[model samples]
Target: MPVDAVEVGDLLLVRPGALVPVDAVLVSEHAVLDESSLTGESLPVERVAGERVSSGAVNGASAVTMRAVALASDSEYQQIVRLVEQAAGSKAKVVRLADRYAVPFTVLSLLIAGVAWAVSGDAVRFAEVLVVATPCPLLIAAPVAFLGGMSRAARHGLIVKGGGTLEQLSRVRSAAFDKTGTITTGRPVLDRIVAAPGFDEKSVLQFAASAEVYSSHVLAKSVVAAAKQQGYALLEAREAEEIATNGVAAQFASDATAAVVTVRVGKPSWLREFAPTLAPAPLEPGELAIYVAVDGRFAGAIVMRDQARGEAGQALHDLRLLGIERTLMVTGDVAATAEPIAARLGIDEVHAECRPSDKVRIVSAVQPRPLIMVGDGLNDAPVLAAADIGFAMGARGATAASESADIVNRYDTLASLPLAVRVGKDTVRIALQSIWLGIIISVALMLVAAFGFLPALVGPGSRRSSTSSRSSVLCAPSDRARSGVRIIADRHGRSCGP
Candidate 1:
């Protein structure tokens, strides 16, 4: 069967919200492609003229035409599928540096052929040795070990997205985490409420909750929660408008007076423009201060505190023990909040007040050998791509983040991170063991081929005494290597340890 079809000349296909099936070059200006399948880039990437593109990557924004650059089988997605296919069908021979050893094995096989030809002086003898000497062990053992490791990981609920990440996990020396949703639960609790100027604690919460009831932001929910817990009767609000990326503004006019009032619940920066004098100075550690205002007047400040996850400390400890030299928390959260969490979890480094792009840059600056980034939000995608290996909290992470990640925690917990590292180590061990077994078996066969024995194919010399008796070759390495009798006898008949 034909492996791939090549396009005659340059074929143009219009891609619209669909992955291109063949590698191509952009023929239209301003074409946007979603390269999640090929490059694992979560965001849509724009392609102009002369930019090379891969197959199985989606096109976005608007339809655009592209010229075929590679045949269907040679595309990136095709190669991935081919690797997975071969891996599934073959028994894994545990072998590292397979490509590195291929040349040596080929040369050795050629030498064996020449030696057999010289010894027997027959061309058929050389062919027999060549046929049996091919290293099937290398092909069969490596993948078996890899698959066994994968099976264990699947049982543990950690999904390694691909073999590349599995291999890199063994070398991870540093791990970076996105703070808000990784080290701590992303939920915030209203810890304290302060009333300003003319408002009491009860009155401030009532107005805040009234404006927040119509909003869906996490902080707004915290406000409504506080009002319910404190037994305050929230006033009905009308025409509540949520300001994007900030807070909510509600229309509240007194029933007795015809006066109109605008109640705003937001951050200190937003209110500073209107009520600069009423803005409270920033507080110290562990406090998440949110500002509130009514009719251009600062109403109060609400302080929030989020609790760290239960497994965070233990996970950090385990990572350090696994030879992860550094553990860093990178987040947009203020220094006051980030520092305490970093201290409590025993993280070695902390980078606070970082924007999404800044977090990527900060993480990218970390020691480069093998870095694993764990995150679960929209902002985590860039850093996820920047890291050598990225683990996404799949259950709670944004779809984009999950798509870009190399591995995913089906159960969102820091606890599973270390378990993943263990699986990777075990997989590498199994692969190596399989390779050694193959090598030993091949070496033993070569020795057998050197001596004439049995009618034992022309590859091995025929021995009259030992060969005439029934003899067979064993391919299993581990069983044969370990089943031999002990050789402890001494020349003087003295006892020797086995």
Candidate 2:
């Protein structure tokens, strides 16, 4: 049946690896679900009968039955979609900066032309005044400066989609970031190894990696990769058994000792049967510890975590220096997992446990107009479209996020964001300078024409010369702006030009 036809109280069958169609109460006695997309939790959750599993969570392993508790439109996933549409609809159209001055300048020119005609009763004088007061500078200068900025940003590994987005970036006062893949590396990595007494760290890691090599879990891959990275020679295991959502057990033949070694690598509770007194190491807020057992005896633990990026702290510091008044961390991860990272990165605020809708609301409510939202997930797509400026970490980010973002960081680093801001500011400055230069020269020529000092017969030639001079002045700033951007990028040890 179509999801639209799913009503409350309807019984639904969710197959393994399939998404739950709607917010539902579990009908099966036991089930496992991967809620990472909805909740940002790295680990799968176990639910029993009567538990409400949210829509969009991936059912794990076995087929399960659930009773629909909400209509499809009112489900969690649809709510996010609705919020995105609403937010996108509410976005104010971007008005070109040059247009703001064009109206006033045009009105003033018409008023001057009318007065000149009235005072001298000469139609040629009014025409001369109007010709010299043309708003060419307003039309030409801003776009050229913005294009130059966009090109410069592209060279620095930032893709700014439009001139207006670049302008908004220049004026950003606040910034919000998604935790996973934005502030931290999205995948788990082995942090450290704690070996039990009489067991060395190398042996513990080797045994665990050997067993985990046969298990298909995200954490297992990290462990195997870690062991291989350290050049640990893996032994062949005979009869490796993987217990779903628990751990893996394997028996390895020892080449040197001429004996069989049994190893267990998994959760503490799962390993407790073999190592009754298993004592796993203490974990930090965002860390996960997988216990290891060698020949039925407890053998240390391998601690792994989604480590924050090395450049994260420096990037936040640079943004603060670049006039970003407030920085916030908005994530679907829980507060306990998010707070430490936020404090470490010096973020001003932390809004944890956010659904996609919650993220949109939080980012939308952030004070100071022109806020920037940086994210890299499917869940971030809606909020990305909603923010004043959305920056997607595009190198490894979700396609939806990249599509909705106004600016994309192609280098897989946050360093481009500050560079983008600097470029925007410089570009806007150069554009205003060009506009004013054109305005001043045009006004001076208009005054001469209005005073009858410049003849009507010579008016077209003078206007051409004046426009040529204004073009030269306007073009100079683009080159200077490029040089300034290069200097700024160089100061930050980045290449900002072709």
Candidate 3:
């Protein structure tokens, strides 16, 4: 338990390598905190000069002073602490068929004992019958089988949340994947360099790449990579500045006076925010448009595209073998960008330009059968939670995604997907086997009790009752011969046998 702020008066001390336990304000200017826990970011960010810091995040780089922003009771980390506490306190609710049948079976045994005692005056015989009639099924097989399946699943790189998620996965008939970073590499890359008449592609790429040096946008990386691949010598840039939502501006050594070159990379709306009259045709399919300008005159545009992941096709094949009837790729990217990747991966369905709510809508429409959504992005969070069984791939970088998903594949191996599906089927198979085994043993007990030879105890007037009400307890291996399940426990009260 964390100490409450009111009790601790006003101040709390946090040292290097220690996680901040409360949300606070940065009193020291140079404080840097690692927010990977909440944001899934790989890098640490400088929290300087009155920035709000969240609790449960680690302090990084430099040490600084902090003032508590959220009280102990109101901290976000407290919610995580409370959830873990709740899951720990929650008990397993699983019970075998015999235990479920215990109450009614015991009642019937008592009534039969009352009649037998009244008719033959054999109270000791009634007690003996009840003792032997206890159902062995509930006491033995079911728990062992479930535990065995859990162990097998853990061996694979999949984490099954519980029996419920295991059951859901076994029934899944369809699979939905997020496009960017899922089917294809999420990073954009240089695919083509088309220069307008009179300008060579090499000369244009040199200007574009050099101007992009001042910007960190994904499009900028694509331009830079193209220049490097072509071995173009980039000219030096002067007075470079990136205008948000518009483009990048820089001075270049050119004949035109006021030779200010601006490189525009995003959507038309974003571009036209600065160059209001510079509306290019609606973006073409499968192409990311980046406009270049020289001296306030439109130069031309360079197009790029995201590439598909190497193992995507093989992953799709494995999923098909695992019995996924339909595999769909849904993404916010344009169809031109998403379609080629989908075709390469042999995806059965494709839904592009999707909003987060749209992803949920499509998932909800999945033919009323169980569906699995695989993703690793903040935008994918809603759909991940909405799916019947969500699997998070590449959990090392995205812990929020891993925690949000029902099953997390830690190694990010597409090969592990089929293994996860098999684990689900195996878990269900084991559970069913245990359930049937319990039923068989309970049936045998019912047969024995029907003979009026099993012991029973009567509770009311003129009634004989059983001394023990063990719903299912077996003493010998022969007792479970027909049950297809065995229980072996040491003197320490631990179950060991199959």
Candidate 2 residue 71 C-alpha distance from true site, Å: 5.9
| Candidate 1 C-alpha lDDT tens digits along 1-498 | 132655734656664666676788887765656543333232235577778887766676356777887787776556544543332334222234444455687688678768877888865545444435546656667667667777788888788876556677777899998776688876666767888878887777888888888764545777888889889877777579876445678888766686777788876777777676676746656556767788888889887766688899998899888889988888766677788888988888888777555766687678855888898865676567667787888877766577667788889788999999978877776776777777667656764554333123333322222221222121111112223555332334432222
Tens-digit per-residue lDDT, 1-498, candidate 3: 445733322455677767777778777655556553444332235566677787766775335668787777787566544433343234234333335655665576566555555665755544434444444444455456556656777787567776666667667789998876566555556666666555676766787888888774435666887888889877677678866435577777663555545544444555555555554634545556677655444455676755666777787798788789998987766676677777877898888777555777788788746888887654465567667777877554245556667787766556676677777787667666765665555445444544554433321111221212322222222232334766654334545344
- Cα lDDT tens digits, model 2, 400-442, are 6888889989988888878888998899889999999999887
lDDT (C-alpha) at residue 135 in model 3: 47
What is the lDDT of every predicted structure here? 0.67, 0.82, 0.62
Off by over 4 Å in 1: 1-97, 116-125, 191-217, 223-282, 289-302, 334-336, 353-365, 454-498
Per lDDT, the best of the predicted structures is: 2
Q: How many residue pairs clash in each candidate at the backbone level?
A: 20, 0, 18
TM-score of 1: 0.56
After best superposition, candidate 3 residue 101: deviation in angstroms? Answer: 9.8
Candidate 3 runs further than 4 Å off: 1-157, 193-214, 222-284, 290-302, 333-340, 393-404, 411-415, 434-498
All candidates: TM-score: 0.56, 0.83, 0.52
Candidates' RMSD to native: 13.8, 10.2, 11.0
